[model samples]
Target: MAGIGFELRKMMRRDTLTGVAKAYLYAGVISSGPLILSIIGMLLIGVLSLGKVIPDFLITQFQVSVTYLIAASLILTGFVQLAFTRFMSDRLFEKRIDLVLPNFNAVVLIATSMSGVIGLVLAFTLFADLSLGYRVLMITGFVILSNIWIAAIVLSSVKEYKHILGTFFIGYTVTVGAALELNRFGLEGLLLGFVIGHFVLLIGLSGLIYRNYPSDRFVSFEVFDKRFAYPSLIFVGFFYNLGVWLDKFMFWFGPGTGQQIIGPLRASAIYDIPVFISYLCVMPGMAAFLVRIEADFVEFYDEFYDAVRSGATLAHIQESRDMMVRTVRAGLYEIMKIQAVVILLIFAFGDWLLDKLGISTLYSPLLRIDVIAASLQVLFLGALNVFFYLDQRKTVFSLSFVFVLLNGVLTALTLHFGPGTYGYGFAGALLLTVIASVYLLDRKFEGLEYETYMLQKS
Candidate 1:
């Protein structure tokens, strides 16, 4: 056991950005296990419910309802992801590891407590809005569990160990069980299973976090600056999420032109659902991109640290601009690889698969649009991440605004034009925005030497 621990630490060693990058990848996988499984499970259910086990009405109901539910959840939790990430980043930058957890503890407790109260109240009141009030209740449950899972990620990002694997499995298994149980109850049941699973896993993860990371090193301080963290995070997070949902909102509102385009409201047919489902593949690429960016920055930070330590001149250190280029390349490579595989799979078996799943007719075009958009977005996301490491936050903000504004305008135009055009317009706009953003961020970071000096000086 002693030897094993030593080996584990060695394996997780990092003298460069890559180490942090690897850790971040592992962190993503561990935390996202449940979500990954749930997504696949939902996909499987999509296949089953599509062609016929469920009637067309049920399938249509499922798609629209799930869309709203997902949108609502994203809006609610979007800020959590940003705030927590910023909190972690600040602590990491300051080299204050312990304070991170205490702050997280404060955040997590407040969120879960609010979720419980709000969920309970909604479970009782919104009973009218949902034919299945139990699903709402289940969502409330997810809120609590999601908070725990987020808390766990905040901890793992700073300090990782093999114990994360065990904890992840525990939560994942619970989720599986919950899914099975909820399957029996239909819509409400599935949601219930999801909620219960998250709840159980949350407890398990919390325990794992406590057992592995104690409060011993926690700082006892009187310093408090809310602006340092929350404002930037909220800004970054809001714009990012806005970029993500912009297309969806457009699709919901825009029909555009085309026999293929299926507006969200008109997407009642099972066949039309595939277009949207194909986009989920982009997630893996997004993950890979983030991991690469993390590693590259870690290397940069280390180099900067070493250069400053030895009193190396700023010009001497400035020669190492290869890090950003490498990061961009790494991200591009991984996204291309993942994208190629998923896209090919979808192409070869898309129609038959959709048929077998009983997808409604209205969704056929949506599947194509979703898949293409997601692939394009993966590269865009990678580029944005690079810009983030470059510390061009203002540039990122500008680019983000463009994405949001353009997507919104496109959506409105599509709606004016009528039904199918929104999807294509939105996807194309997103891809274009990515190219534009990357170009601008690169320009902003053109004077890397000065930035490096400033960054190192601080």
Candidate 2:
């Protein structure tokens, strides 16, 4: 991501207004393109289905099913996402690029097998009432989506951003077209179309990965190699993803907030909509993160760490460390500035926008709250990225754990407290987490000189 950010900054070296605009446009697309495309594609499907050949109820069912597919797939694959990323990053660091594709393939294979079994069990038992074909399609979609997510994490690390965007466009185009064309078959058709589209996406991503790292061997289980596996990263990945989704899950099954949308599936109309919109609002902040943190902070980080490793003079090392700290501060400051503008714009025009879209005014307050929370989430991500660069696994795990636990407890309390309080729990949790992260980051940087020199002696 930082690499892409650097590339964007280089392109904007002209410093013209047009150059700046293009830089951010490219940054937004590279940083959040796939997700934005997915959201738009799904929303388009929902909108276009209205007054079309498909029945309204089936469309609703399709939306609910796809929502679960996304959530479950992300959480399931999150267990392996960062671990595999670390594995590949280590291989890259060692200049053993040849090992990357094989090990990544190994991770995908393991994830697929596990998710397949889980999907099958749930599909057959929980969805036994649905047709056999529907169950099979559901399981297939879940497995494919899971693999795609894991692949996406690794693919993003490489430099084929354009190929990824092209694949997403082609894949989702197929999805919307196929779903509309196959509406005659009901929900099963929609699900099947989704599975097919995602399979195309999987193939495209896998093909690109393979092309980049061609292997003569058919399969490799090297990701399970003890030398490569980082258990801390595995836990960090799983916990962080779980923390992000925990509040939503609680809301889904909450006493008053949720109801069954499908067999053993639930949706909270009040909670889901605002949360999704909030996530959308994070795109600008995400772009800023990639630009400022990845581009600026990382450059100094490389210099500081390299100086330490090279046995440079104490003065040089201190200078590099100071520069790194400054860069981090500037990066975080940039994110806040950009996101503040975004939030203010949304707040001012949100009601009119929602009204135009036929969304209820009831959702306006929650949208504002969620945008703040999501903005804080970007800062949290920046903090986590820095921690990872420093190999601070314990801090990452602790923060993730607290995020999940605090969000759950506070959100539950909010539910008990009543309506006006609905979105505050998520906001509060994120705010506290950000404060802690900022403090820890500052403390960690302050002690870098001591840690780099004295810790080695001790």
- Report the C-alpha lDDT of model 2 over 79-126, residue by residue, as the tens digit: 898888777777777877788787877888888898899988887688
- In candidate 1, stretches whose alpha carbon ends up further than 4 angstroms from where it belongs are 1-36, 44-69, 113-139, 145-149, 152-166, 216-224, 249-272, 308-310, 314-316, 360-365, 418-422, 454-458
Q: Least lDDT summed over 10 consecutive residues: which range in candidate 2?
A: 1-10
Clashes found in each candidate (C-alpha, N, C closer than 3 A): 32, 0
RMSD of each: 6.1, 1.8
Instruction: Give the TM-score of each candidate.
Output: 0.76, 0.95
Model 1: lowest-lDDT 10 consecutive positions: 257-266
lDDT agreement of model 2 with the native = 0.81
Cα lDDT tens digits, model 1, 181-209, are 45645555555555666677677767755
Q: How much lDDT does each candidate structure score?
A: 0.57, 0.81
Instruction: Kindly report which residue pairs in candidate 2 clash with one another.
Output: none
